[model samples]
Structure formats: structure tokens, C-alpha cells
Target chain A: MKWWLIAWREIRWEVFLDRASLLRTAIFVVIPIFFVFGNRGLPGGQAGEATIVALALQSVFFPSLAGVSLIAATFTAEKENGTLVPLLAAPIRDFDIVLGKLIGMVAPVLAACAVTLAAAYALASYRYGAERIAHTLTPQLIYALLVLSLLYLVTTGSVTMIVAARVRSSRAAQQLAGLVIAISAAVFGGLGVVASQLADGWALVAVGVLLVFFDVGALEIARRVWQRGEVIGRI
Target chain B: MIEVRNVTRRFDGVVALADASFEVRPGEIVALLGPNGAGKTTASRIIGGILAPSEGDVLVDGISVRVDPNGVRARCGFVTDQPSLYDRMPLLEYLAFFARLYDVSSPDHRAVELAKLLGLDDVLAKRLGAFSRGMRQKVAIARALVHDPPVLLLDEPATALDPEMAQTLRSFIVSLRARHRAILLTTHDLDEAQRIADRVVVLYKGRVIRIGATSEIRAGGKPSYLLAFAGEASAARDALSRIGIEAQPAASEDGLAALRFATDDPRRTNGAALRALLDAGIEVVTLAAEERSLEDAYLAILAEARQ
Candidate 1:
């Protein structure tokens, strides 16, 4: 129950109270939309469709990176500022702590991703005729993109939460998170290039299912490693 | 009530506290006194449920910290030297946030009440980061008391306060005992401890050297006498030297001299000195035993422990 309270507080703090982080999220979400619309009136071809898909994916990717920052700040920043002591002193379970932080971070970033994706879709329909847009927008691709975004959110959010829990210093956690995100983006980009070749419904569903399993595995690992003693003792 | 029974805490093979046993009953304040590195903080942390003892157990209201730390924490309020408060939050909001976390029925009401009690009513809406050290300390104190816990642990709560502010904080702490709450105060300030604590436990080198009523601990020191003379001080000094007694002039007036001397037994020594002064024609105005100071007793205990 208290963890849900913490999650609510975390979301409110990030979305409303922390204007700077909100502005950063806005910039990350809106910039890619500008890029997608800036290429208006370009001739439609295989390259044009690929470019649109890449722009949409970029929108998802940036917010996913932003999710890492949110997770890092959620755990590591509290620890760094010394507020973690009182928070830990409360009658809160360790699992709830991690779960609350995950919810807190993932929600806002996913919301931003949704908005970015919507803007991308609107711009694509405006740039090309509705019929052309419909012909180009494969249902499987849309489903894969949504699944891929969810997978990225969970993967990056879980890893960032783990790093934040283990690392004592907030700055170190953030820096380590940046490194992890960079490596993840490179690997995901490679997978995306291959995924473009097999844009079938079965393959997309298979990958989505696999990613869900991976998300659960990562969450479990995070839960197991977050010992209250080691986290508080490091300070 | 809180009990720390034979608790020991070690860090990297070095003992921070050893066999530390003490209890604070309801409505009583126990001050843990020691110099730096004396394990005062470690003992308080163990009792606060923030640090687990390497050995033994700490019980708060009959709940063992080793067995159920969360249960102990729920009933304990802890205020450290530097409270880690959120800079972006208003003092009132911060209090409310913690109150909610503790599941207080009415968080805003509790926050207002705590702010008023801690003299923070005027600055309740001010950001905590903008607060001065004294203001921050008050808010930290308010934060601790927000839930009205049955026990409180304070570690050097007045580390850098001015004399006036320190006195205010001391009075406030003393007032808490009236609420029937058990309080464990850890501080290096012996005078503060003596002034506020009903009982004191002296720690040295991670070990409990002594624990008793403040007056009892003070009475362990050697007794001294203050004598007032109406005549010349040198004459009294000379006469006392002749009688094989040594006395130092503590003060002097136009026609009076005050002397101080130490003795193991005040009654017998004062009698012999008075008789000697009367025989030598030295008018003695007043003679009284000087009260033993807690500082002197603390120093004596530390010296003895060293030896």
C-alpha cells in the first residue's frame, strides 16, 4: 500500500514538480516529431518508408533512454540526498520499494513514448495520402513497434533500477545507466535491422512473448539483488 | 521502553561496540555519553533499528530488532545530526509525506501540529533547502515527531547550534519525556547530558564504563570544601600549612578570604580545620563542601578507564 503511495509520489514529482525533467522529456519526445515532419513532401519509396519507420523508432528509443534517467533518479538520487534512510526506516518491504520505483519510472516514459508515437503517426498520414499511409503501415510492423517499445521500457527500466539499487552514488548510477543504454541501443539497433526482414505476424508475436519472459527474468534478478542491508550500508 | 542487551557491533573486524547493555523506561531519558569513537552513535543506531548488531539483540517495546526490525522502526523516531530532507519540498509537505508513509490517519493535521510544536508555523511553506541549520534541525525534529512514536533516538541533535538555540532544543527534548516516551540521547556534550538526562551511560572504547543516576555518577568524584575567612588570606594559608593542611585562596573580599581544599572525607577534615583556625585566632566565616561537577566525574571516569 505504501509502495503504491511512493509510486504516486514519484510520478507526481517527475511529471509536475520537477519542471526540469519534464522539459527534458518534452525535448526528447518532441524533437523526433519535428524530424519526422521536417521531411514533408518527400517522394514515397522503399527508402522513404524505411526512413519513416526509423524516425518512429527513434521517438520510442529516446523515451526509453529517458526512462533510464527516471529510474536512476528515483532510487539513486534519494539515496544520495540522504532521504533514503527515513524512507527505509518506514515499515516498507524491500520488494515494494523496487516495484514502486519501477512503476514510477516506467509510467511517465511510456506515456511520453505514446505521445511521440501518436505524433509520428499523424505526421506520416499528413506527409503521405491516407491510402498511401495505410498501404505502407503494416499491422505487423505497428504491433512489433509497440511490443518492441514495451520490451525496451521493461528491459531498460529493470537494468537501471538494479544499477540504482546497487550503486551508492546517484551520479555513478546515472553514468553507468548511460553506458548500459548505449550498449543496449547498439544491440537493439542490430536486431531491428534483422527484424525488418521478418515482418510477419507470427515472428512479431514470438519476439514479443520472448521479451515478456525476459522482462520477468530481469525483474526477478533485480528483486533478488536489492538487499536493504547492502544498499543502506554502502552509504 | 527500549532495551539493548549485550549488543555488539563490528565493522571489518574492528569492534564498534561490545556488550553494550542499557534500558530506557517509559518517561525516562537516557543519555549515551562518550567521546568520539566511543560507540555512542553505534549503540543508538542499533536501538533505532537502522543497524543490526553483530551480536545480541535490541528490543523496543518488547519487539526484538533482530527478529522484527520493521516493527521496531515503526515505533521509533530517529533524528540524526544532519537530517537528509528533500530540498525541493516545503517543510510542511515533507512532514506530511512522511506522516502518510507512516500511515498516520490525518497527515495534514499532524504536519501542522508538529510544525507548531517545533516553532515552525511561520515557515511551513518554505522550501527546506532555503532553511538555516537551526531551522533545518527544527524541521528534522518535527519530521521525527510527526507520527508520535513511542520511542525517540537522537544522535547529537545540537551539534552546531548556538547556546540559546541549544537550550531551546534541550528544553524541547526534556518536554518529550513528559509524554511518557522513552528517549535515548547520544551526545559528546557532558554538560548537556547532565542537564537533561535522568540517567547516563558512559561508553569508552566500545565498552560501557558506567551507568547510573547522574548524581550518583557525580558523587563518585573526590569531595572538596570551600572555606571563607574574615582575615588576611596569607595568615589563614600559613596557619593551615603549620597544621599540615593545604588550602588555596579561591577568592578575596575587602576583609575576607575564600579558600578551597580537597579531601577524601569532608566531615572529619572540616572539623579539624575549623578547630585549627579557631585556635590560631583566624576567624572562619563559612565552610561548605563544594558540589561535585558532572564534568569532573566524567573526566575522572575517563582517566580511570585509561589507566
Candidate 2:
């Protein structure tokens, strides 16, 4: 419950009210629309599939990357602004603080991803025909778009929080977050390609399992690393 | 009700606070005074349970910080030099958020009550980013008090405030003592501490060198008295010399000569000096004791600690 309160405040301040963060979300949301229209150049049947892949990639990578940037800034920004000390002084558990921040940071990014996918879906349906769009929307693709995006968010968010906790400055944290996002994009991109060529839904399911492992490992590491003493010492 | 017993904190083999022990009873304010790098902040953080001690323990209302830090923290409210507020959040919302964090019942009502008490009622709707340094400090204080904790740890709460604002804050802190909140204030401002602190613990190089009442620390040296006379300077000097009393010349007032001197026994030495002056036919107009400021005693104490 305390963690929820913390998460609510983070969402309100960092997402809804912060102009810079809102603008960043807006940019990511609009980028998927361009991807939707760009895929129109491909030939009929293959074009629909490419559009799904492209939109799903954008949907997974872009907003998760945005979330990584935001999560990475979580502690470093608090340190820079001198808010970490007071927050750490509060009675909340270190686990609660980390969990609250994780939920808070990922929620906004997921919301942005949903909006991006919605806009892209409508645009692709209008640019291409409804039947063609419907033909490409398989269960596997839908699973990839939704579950895979969430896994990617949790994995990257947790890993980036580890980097954020260790770093001294927000700029350094953001740079490291970018590096983490790039590595994630490559790994997930390769997995997507292999899943498409191999056993389709089964391969995608294996990818989801692997991401779950990654999310669990990263979350455990994050929880262990995020100690109040360590955080205050860094500050 | 805050007891920091034999607490030591080290960072990377460097001792920041070493074997420090102190107590702030209910309804008392103890000032933790030190120079730069003296570990005042470290001690405060340890007491507030923000940092674990490398050795020993701190107990807030008998809740051991080592065993249950969160429980100790729940009973303590910490305020640092910087307000460190979310600039975009309104004051009311910010206070309410902290109140809820502390699990206070009726958090919104508590926030409003604190705002009104801190004289921020008119600006409850204003965003904290637009506040001045003093106002931000007040907001920080309000947030700390929203839970109505039994112990309050204030680290340089009036670092950058204007003189008037500092006075207001000092008065407010003094008022908190009546509510029986044990307050441990860490500061570089000796005057502020002297004004409000019931007792002071002087820390030098992470060690508690002196801990005593404010007046005791201020009068840390031999007692001295000043004598004002209606006689010539040479006569006054000679009259004191006859009694084996060495008196230094002090500033004259209203066409009268004055001399200052220290005595181990004021009652005996003062009476002898006055008798000597009368015997010398020199009129002794007035005799008064000189008061030493806390700043003077603090410097002397630090100098001795360095030795």
C-alpha cells in the first residue's frame, strides 16, 4: 500500500505533470505512426506481415527504451536534486521503494506503448485494407506485441535501475540506459527474427520464457543492490 | 526520547563518526555542533535510521535502529538543509503524500493542519518550485511533522534563510520543545544553537569532545569581572597592583575608568580588590562580571580538542 502511494506520486509528477517527460512520451507515441505508413511500400501479402512485425518491434523497443531512460533517471535524478536522502529517511522498506519506483516508471511507458500501438493499428488499417490487416493479426503477433513488450519493460526497467543506483549522475545513468536499451533491442530483435522463421508461436513462447527468466534475474539483482546505505553513500 | 549509544560509522575505511554517544530526552533540544567534516550529518542520519552504524546502536523511543530500522524511522522525522521537494507538486499534495507515507490517519487533514500551523495556509495550492528557500524549508519541516513523530532530527534547517526567517524558524523550533518532541539539531550556526538549544554536544573530528548545558559550555573558562571606577587610570592600576591583582584596562564609560580581570574565587578576590581601592582612596563605582559568548567557548573548545 505504501509502495502504491509512492508509485502514484511518481506517475503524477514524472508523467502527467512533467513537460519534458510528456514530450518524450509524445515523440515515442508518434514514431510508431510513421512506421505504420512506411510499411505500405511492401507487396500485398508480405506487406501486412511486415507491418505487424515493424509495429510490434516499434511498440516493444521504443516505449521500453523510453521506460529504460526514465527508470535509469529514477535514483540519479533524486540524488542530483537532493530528494533521495529524505525519501530514504522515510519508514518505507528498501524493497518497497524499489518496487514502487519500478511500477511507477514502467506504468507510464506501458501507457505510451498502448497508445502508440492503438494509433499504429488504426493507421495501418486505413492505409492498407481491413482484411489485409486482419490477416496479419495472428495470436502469436498479438502475444509478441503485448506479453513480450511487458517482459521487455520489466527486464530493461530492472537492469536500468541497477545502473541508476550505481551511477553518480543522471546523465551517466541515461547514457548507460541507452546502452542497455541497445543491447536489449539487438537481443530481442534477433529472437523475433528467429521466432518468425522457426516454429512460429512455439519459438515466440520460448522467447517469452527466456524474457521471464531475464526479468526475474534482473529484478532480484535490483532488489539486492538497492540498499538505503549504498544509495546514501553514493549521494 | 532519542539515544545514540556508542555509534560509529565508517566509509571505505575512513571513520566518519567514531564512538559517538548522546541522548535527547523528551521536551529537550540538543544541538550537535561541529566544524566542516565533523560528521554531524552522519550522526543525524544514523539516529534517523537512514544509515546503519558500523558499531553500537540508536534507539528512538526505545525502538532499536539496528534491529528494527523502519520501526525507529516511523517514530522519527528527518529534515535536511535542502528542502528537496518535488517542484511540480502542489504544497498540499506534497504534504499529504508524506503523511500517507508515514501511515498517518487522515493524511489530508494532517497536511492541512500542518500547513496552517506553519503559516503556509495561503500558499497550500501553490507549487513548491515557486517557493522561496525559507518557504521550502518550512514545507520540509511541515512534511517532517505531518506524522507527528516523537523524535525530530533537523540537519542545518536554517542554513540559507534570511535573518528574520531564521528567527521565525528558531522560535518555531523552540515551540516544538513544549510538545515533548526530542529534537536533535545539527548546525554550523553557533548563535542559532545558543539561542534555542537546551544543551549542546560539540563534535570534533567525529568524536564528542564536550557535552553540557548551553550556559556551561559558554562559561567554559575562568570567571572574569569588570570594575568601573571614578578615579584615574594610573591610580586604578596601582590600587589593583598593591593587592597582587593584575587587571587589564577595559573601555571607559561616562568619564569613568574601568578594568577587567579574571579570578578563580570571585567572592574573595573581588572583595579584596574593592578594599584595596578604598584604602588607596580610589572610588570604585561599579563591579560587574563579564559574559563569554558561546562562539568564544566553542573556539576554545575546538582548539583544545585539536591538541
Best-fitting candidate, measured by lDDT? Answer: 2
What does the lDDT read for residue B58 in candidate 1?
95
Please state the Cα-based DockQ of model 2 relative to the true two-chain complex: 0.76
DockQ list for all candidates: 0.47, 0.76
- Residue A97 of model 2 has an lDDT of 83
Tens digit of lDDT per residue, candidate 2, span A1-235?
7889889889988668878777787777777777777764546567557756677568656766778888888878888898878788888888888889899988878878877776776777787766676678665666658777788888888889887888899899989988998897788778878886877557877878887888878777887787666777777
- What would the DockQ be for model 1? 0.47
lDDT (0-100) at residue B34 of candidate 1?
85
Question: Candidate 2 chain A — worst ten consecutive residues by lDDT sum?
Answer: A39-48
Interface RMSD of each: 1.9, 1.0
lDDT of 2 at A178: 86
Residue B305 displacement (Å), model 2:
0.6
**Tens digit per residue, CA lDDT, model 1, B104-214:** 999999999999888889988898889999989888888888879999999899988889999999999989999899999998888898898999899999999999998
Tell me how far the alpha carbon of residue A124 in candidate 1 is from the true structure, in angstroms, after superposition: 2.2
